[model samples]
Target: MPPLRPELQAAHDEMDETGQDYAFAVCPTWQGDAWEVNTKEVNIYSALSGTFKSHAEATAAGTAWLLGV
Candidate 1:
């Protein structure tokens, strides 16, 4: 993975800390020598959407979207 800019990293980190109501779904997949940041809304790990506000939020959203509700 490439290095993220300091500002970008700060924004993301801030979002993470206070963004508990935010969705952050990350599916780590090993393709060969690197891990791919798979889709957050859909994929094998599509179990995350909007559940916990963070990962929970994502999961809830995923389930809901999957159910078409």
Candidate 2:
């Protein structure tokens, strides 16, 4: 979705190579066409408080963050 940020993509790729169990949580942002890992309903406190261009991007980035990759 919107081509995941390079770092997140790299992290995801690395996780794939490392055979790590990683999953992402994605939810819509207050604004349409955007998604985020952190939201008012879910208190995910970390550096991944980024507004992604789409749900897929947000989910991938959140997975990378959760894996600390």
Candidate 3:
């Protein structure tokens, strides 16, 4: 696997520290398909891509971040 970027590492750290699921999704207010940060995971198909992910790890993790793994 490629080395994770610092920002990606930081995001994972923040997710772990806060016990919240972090995911990438389309910016609701933005006018494009590009993804942005999001907390809700109920219906996040907008995540065109994923940087990191976990599943069934914890309930407080904002969204399960199931990277199909």
Candidate 4:
């Protein structure tokens, strides 16, 4: 996978219930007004839709969805 931005730290490096390894990170949108939660499972990468006002919010939401918490 490509490297994350210098200002951004890596997040979510745990396996889900099905034992699939995954990771997620909060990236700035193209417009730079909000954050998008980007996830990686196996070799596929995707971004979840949502408007997060801050990086922490995006990270929390992504973690919940990824872990099914």
Candidate 5:
């Protein structure tokens, strides 16, 4: 598996406090111009949709989704 990006690592750290089993990924768009956040355990939380302009935005969205904020 590829290493987690800094933004993702920070988001994961925040999510860890929620005490829930959540799995997600932040990936680059096909055009390599944006970021996308996808969750494996959508049943546990609302899926974060739409592409983000940067890794930070994607990470924030994922963190909010996992933390239910």
Candidate 6:
């Protein structure tokens, strides 16, 4: 896999601080051309939430959730 986007990396790092293992990846949507950042536990099969258009959005949302912001 390619290196994760910086925002994603930051989110991962933030998650790590909480002892939650999560993954951030770009996934193709059922809409064909649409793609999103898929956030989930590292070894989980389902996504924790809906996808975001870019890594930064995904990271921001995930980070906020984690921080209860």
RMSD of each: 11.6, 11.0, 10.9, 5.3, 6.1, 7.0
Highest-TM-score candidate: 4
Give the lDDT ranking, best first: 4, 5, 2, 6, 3, 1
Higher lDDT: candidate 3 or 6?
Answer: 6
**Clash count (model 2, backbone only):** 0
Report the alpha-carbon TM-score of model 5 versus the true structure: 0.57
Q: Name the lDDT value of residue 50 in candidate 5.
A: 82
User: Candidate 5, overall lDDT?
Assistant: 0.66
lDDT of 4 at 6: 43
TM-scores for all candidates: the values are: 0.30, 0.46, 0.32, 0.64, 0.57, 0.36
Per candidate, the number of residue pairs that clash is 15, 0, 3, 0, 0, 0
lDDT of 5 by residue, 1-69 (tens): 897656555545555555556756576766779987766463443336689999899888877776773
| Candidate 3 Cα misplacement greater than 4 A, ranges | 21-35, 38-69
Clash pairs detected, candidate 6: none
Alpha carbon lDDT of each predicted model: 0.36, 0.54, 0.36, 0.68, 0.66, 0.53
- lDDT by residue for model 4 (1-69), tens: 897554243333322333565767677776789887877787666677776999889989888878972
Model 3, 1-69: lDDT tens digits are: 896455445544544555434353223223333233434343322233332232222222323344531
- lDDT for each residue of candidate 2 in 1-69, tens digit (9 for 90 to 100): 398665445444544554434434455554556766641113222335668887778877876666664
Q: Which residues of candidate 2, in runs, are more than 4 Å off? A: 1-24, 39-47
Candidate 6 minimal-lDDT segment of 10 residues: 39-48
Q: After superposition, how far is residue 45 of candidate 5 from its true place, in Å?
A: 12
Q: Residue 59 CA error for candidate 1 (Å)?
A: 26
lDDT of prediction 3: 0.36
| C-alpha RMSD (angstroms) for model 6 | 7.0
